[model samples]
Target: MPLTDAKARNAKPKNNQFKLFDTDGLFLLVSPAGGKWWRFKYRLGGKEKLISLGTYPEVSLAQARARRDEARGQVADGIDPSQARKALKAARVQNESTFEVVAREWHTKFTPTWTPGHAVTIKSRLEFNVFPWIGERPVNEIKAPELLMVLRRIESRGAFETAHRIRSICGQVFRYAVATGRAERDPAADLRGALPPVKPKHHSAITDPEKVAGLLRAIDSYQGSLVTKCALRLAPYLFVRPGELRQMEWAQINLEAGEWNIPAEKMKTRQPHLVPLAHQTLEILRELHPLTGTGKYVFPNPRTSKRPMSNNAVLAALRRMGFEKEEMTGHGFRAMART
Candidate 1:
């Protein structure tokens, strides 16, 4: 007989488990503990098998009958419904594992080789750009279109280079997922030529000897602070990165040896660097030493003298000297010296 809701709900439990047969081997099993379970009794390859559809109320009589009909159709095609159910459940678990979960796991394994700042930057980039859009989606199920949509949002903000970098980062995460069996393939790898090209932008520099001379003359006559004036004067001689120069510590400079021994941590490459000081550079350092020698930084902030000089100090000085941003930046000294 087909089981109705009232028949199943009013069914009494006994000292032993009992089954109220519905039809075609679908029945409601009422346990001694008063729990009702919907189950399908079936046979495959002439051997008997049982599959649990769901519990009562959750799996109503009509829903259980529908599932039974579907399973019956599968059995008619000689497919084992129990095995099919197991595969579906496993797939569901895998899908719930999620992109964010796998990406974070990949990050944890990979961050050990990265510097603290680099690690923080990568995590921040993912959280800001990728997380809100599709981070919760299953990594394996994410298609190229979905990822391109994420990149497009970044592109819309005019962060073309950032979008490219994020694509690369996502590729790494996807590859990690693939290698670890969390995903089947990298969707990001399928997105070649999808983003805008990233052009290399070199810092503007005065490389011509004549223009360089003119720039030096302008720096000398600048009416900025004496400390800033000295930094501007010394920049051309040292020719290190602007941040490296501004964050320079007194201890790193060997005025006697005419060399600045930049520690690996302070350098962009994470490798120690040597900057040979010219005679004029030594004189400038010696002259400025009296003013900032006692402080931790060679070019301490003018307002406080407790920290390194502002990152904009040299750039602002260049602006004041009539060198437009396209003409020069604090970083331009490297190219100028290289030239």
Candidate 2:
């Protein structure tokens, strides 16, 4: 006889396991240990076969019957329900392994070898440019044209350089996916010369000694944030990268030793660098020490002492002193020193 909800729930376990038959080959298997399991029994290819539906209380009487009817329908159509279930599970797993997932995994794995600033830049680029477009697509299924469309979107904004960078980053991600068995091949590899080449840009510098002197005179006369003013003063003296200069920490400087020790993590070459302080540089440092000596950075942000000054602080100071971008820039100090 077919089982009902009351019969299934109230049924007690016997000394041995037994089955309570329900309609359409569905039944409740009450074990000797008081465990109630729902199962389906059916015939296929003129032989009997059985499959598990679920457990009691979890898969109640009506739900078990529904599942049984579904499985029986599969048999009528000559499709084995077991194989279909496996295929569905595999599809779900593949869908969950997306481009964003694999790319982020690759990033996390290699971030330890990269500088903090470089790592942050790469992550920000991927999140802002790549993820929103193709992140959800399965890594294995992404095609070359699809990736080109993503790069073309970046190019549409006149950011030719940034577009090329995004393409390179995507190529790295696709290569990682291939090595890790998530993708068959890198679609980014097929996009060779797909974007315009970025022109090499040089920082504009005033190499003439007379103009250099004029720039120095202008910096001395300028009145701005004291931190910015000090940074501007040190730019000509140190001629370090603007980033390296701005991020200088109090701990890295020694007034008595007349030296600044920059760590490897902050350097572009990933090597420790030492900058010997000149007498003029020492004097500037001493004069500014009273105001920011207790802070972490030599040039702390004017609004927040916890952070370094803006990367553009020196550039903005030059602009305020009437220097055009083509005439001079924060990075121009390096070139000016070489000349």
Best by lDDT: 2
**Tens digit per residue, CA lDDT, model 2, 1-339:** 778899899999999999999988888899999999988888888888888999999988888888998998999999887777889988887876798998899999988767887889999999999999999999999999999999999999998898888888999999998898888898988988888888989999998999999999999988997888888999999989999999999899999999999998888877899999999999999989999999999999988999999877888889999999999999999999789
For residues 164-266, write the lDDT of model 1, one tens digit per residue. 9999999999999889878889999899999979998899998999999999999889998878898899888877888888889899999899999998777
Candidate 1 stretches with Cα past 4 Å from truth are 1-97, 105-120, 178-181
* Candidate whose TM-score is highest: 2
Model 2 TM: 0.68
Q: What TM-scores do the predictions have?
A: 0.66, 0.68
Query: lDDT, candidate 1, residue 84?
Result: 94
> Residue 100 of candidate 1: its Cα lDDT?
87
> RMSD of model 2, in Å?
5.8
Task: Return the lDDT, model 1, position 50.
Answer: 94
